[model samples]
Target: MCVLIKKYKHINTNNYNVLENALTYDIQRIENDLKKNHNSDYFLIINDEGRLGKMRKIQRINYIPSIIFLSEIELLIEDSLPKASKNSRFIQILDTISYIVYLYCLEHFNNSRWANRVRNKLNFEDVINLLDKIKNNSNIQASRTNSYGIVHYPR
Candidate 1:
């Protein structure tokens, strides 16, 4: 299995709009960054022979991860955050992100993979409480394509 992760070991906090500031600022900044990475009108797809053999016109929202890619995310997250006896806050945060991606795929694509066990493990609307703190009633406040999503979502 292939996994790519960027460990921000030494982040210059000033250069980034972090969690301590207004959540709105972070959400807007993330949205703007996603806009900058937009792919062209056509997207390349592989054919039955396992080769890059075709290109199809796509809508902007077609930039979403496939089941196989989400499976890879499950693999990588396991490596990064193992099943510990007691979960840490950071681990919970990462798990919330995984749940977000998993649910988004299910809701938007009307597709899901058996290999992705996140939804099975989660209770109904587990992240709902997080919304209570925010004045804006956005169900999905923010989403960023972290390494794998950045590479595979457009394919």
Candidate 2:
């Protein structure tokens, strides 16, 4: 299973503590804590050892308080899929894909400073073309940060 462990950078604190070095120990702990309470194929470990203000981003996604939260997409599917009958999975998959696309667009637009340079000429069709370019290109994270930073485009 692919694991995405989100580790936060220490803020003002200077303590550098190493976590688990062995997979056996970690897997045992996860099994006892996660599998015992919840069913999941994969675990997303959210580490918030040092983050303070930055924790807001994580909290906003969950709408709850937690030092760490584990989510099982499959289990969530098992529970919520019935609401849409036969097409639930397809809809859910599409929604997930669309969100990824939106974030990719945001990352690209934020990086390019296209808003400032071409905002005057960018109509709805032009904006869609920008989205197409960002979606087509695979290497987006390494792109440059916008000189003017990020501005939310109004819907």
Candidate 3:
């Protein structure tokens, strides 16, 4: 596995609208790329920071199933309390974004031997519920500690 790092300044909280728009565009682009590049393994890393730099790295590498980071999505949902009008639609957007990723994996990789081995582990509902709880400020509990260390989920 290759790890690449890039540096960037922190984002201002007030600019979330711009961030949200960018994320929406990137997610759609990723989905389209996945459709066109069916043979590549697309790995998207979602986090609250370092999104642009990571995206730039992936673009430089010219890798397929392009890697993307959903930092804007996480920031818009987790950094502030949800409000009416503006932030309310975040949940729906997140649902659509994650569903696209999940659907791509299921439909494109289903025939792969490794996919069959790990099919039971791919659950999109868990992701949606986690985002919902974050948006609603509900209690979230630890689900399981996989080889990836500790993982949390909405109970």
Question: 1-155, model 2: which lDDT tens digit per residue?
Answer: 11111123324435632122122223334444445555555444332233333332332233221227654222111111113313456556544544444444444543423456445755445545645554443322222452221222121
* Candidate 3 structure quality by residue, lDDT tens digits, 45-106: 34423354444433322322333643322111122222333344655565554544344333
Q: In terms of TM-score, which candidate is stronger, 2 or 3?
A: 3
Candidate 1 residue lDDT tens string, 1-155: 01112223226445542222222232223333344454222222221221112112111222323334311111111111123323456555544555554454444343444345655765435533332332132323233443222221122
Descending-TM-score candidate ranking: 1, 3, 2
> What's the C-alpha lDDT at position 88 in model 2?
58
- Give TM-scores for every candidate, taking all chains together and pairing residue i with residue i: 0.24, 0.20, 0.21
lDDT order, best first, reads 3, 2, 1
Model 2 TM-score on a 0 to 1 scale: 0.20
In model 2, the clashing pairs are none
Q: Candidate 3's C-alpha lDDT?
A: 0.36
- Candidate 1: segments with Cα more than 4 A from true spot: 1-85, 110-154
